[model samples]
Target: MKGVMASVQDVGAPREKLQALEKIEQDIAAALSSAASALQELSKDKPAQKHVDSHSTAFIKTLQEVENGLSQQISYLSQVTTSQPHEGSSYGSQKDMHMAMHRSAHVKSRLSELEKLKMEHLMQKHTGILRSYSASNDSQQPLTPHTPQQPHTPQPHQQPQQQQQQQKQTREQQAQL
Candidate 1:
């Protein structure tokens, strides 16, 4: 009989959440750029109805705040996420190893997200930087940004499969260590 091991396989990704976040991020990012432009438009020190576009004064303020906060987080979150060291396993029961794999999967998923966000942040940073640095002659462009399927339902049996794979990989890594 083949004993179950802690599985350590890539469990795809949370597509819906990722898609939603990416969409929201794009929307917010666009809003931010538009708000910046509107700000530049408004702060022109000119008085005109055209200058006073539909963008709310309050909305602009909020976008600026969010942009700043997200910008800061992008730099920091990316760095910390990449630098995070994976903890060594405590080395115990089959159950423990199994649990560890699930936890590691969760961490991996989060790290992947953080890394992606970090990249997006960097892109945004450069976009803002270049545009600001060369507002005089920058060309017009719109920045835009994956597919994963969800299981029909959770598989309790798959848990053992994942765990067994996890155990095998863990043991191999540990042996090398």
Candidate 2:
């Protein structure tokens, strides 16, 4: 009876841990979604600097949360896998080990995705800052007085009669010479 009770408790323990990991994964996914939405909003045409700064800060905070959640998931998965049944040490069933490995792989993929998103966010933020700086500079510059442009000289095609008379005179002079 004692051995059976211990076996049941051991099985229940890994299940509870896996449930906790799933909860964390869900939270991380939500954070990533929020970050993505913020990026989209920031990409809209001509947002103010104040809005950009606030969005960027929010994005950074969400990213940090996702990273922290991934770290915790990784550490927890490591513990589960390392303590798995091996030659008589009954820590968890093979199913638990497989699940932990699968979860670890998923977390790693999410981390890579998070890295790509971070790079995109940084680039967006940099471009926004540059645009605002250039816009501010343009607004501060004094406008120079407009001046009328000089009229263009008429082409030969546009003054055909004058050109023809000049050509006729030149021919007459050349014939006399």
Candidate 3:
């Protein structure tokens, strides 16, 4: 009876240790499950983040292309407005000359329109910059109006004509003297 009692006690001790080990294993499995769920959630968000990033990049690229096109148009208008008229070009008749003059007037008007658009674009860009700067600085100062300066371009033909007139006037004065 004494030996049987000792054997029973030894068996009970091993059963308790086995139960503890099974509990520890269950806790480890629960922790691993929680970590796996968290990783899955993060992975799901990654695709959304990538989608947003791609959209923003595309938007920026499109905006840059539009800005480049506007700049090119502005340059073309400036060139047309500053170009010298070909006065020596042979026109078959007065009607042809009149048509040429009309075309020139049309181009000038279009150039003026483009210039206004350029000015507006510049104003908007500056306003945005100023707004951002003021916001960052926490300043509430009134924004001053910015005036775009018009470049003075002298006509190529006018200078020589003016010099000739001046020489002619000098000759007349010398003769009078």
Indicate the residue-level lDDT of 33 in model 1. Answer: 67
The predicted structure with the larger TM-score, 2 or 3, is 2
25 Cα displacement, candidate 1 (Å): 69
lDDT of 3 by residue, 33-132 (tens): 5445445545673545555455455545545544544444344344335552322223245557899999999999999999999999966876665565
Candidate 1 lDDT tens digits, 47-68: 3546456555545765665565
lDDT over C-alpha atoms for residue 174 of model 2: 38
Better of 2 and 3 by lDDT: 2
Better of 1 and 3 by lDDT: 3
Model 2's TM-score against the true structure = 0.33
Scored by TM-score, the top model is 2
Candidate 2 weakest lDDT stretch, 10 residues: 143-152
Model 2 C-alpha lDDT per residue in residues 34-70, reported as the tens digit of each score: 6676677678896566766666676677667556555
lDDT at 75, model 2: 50
Candidate 1 lDDT (Cα, 0 to 1) = 0.50
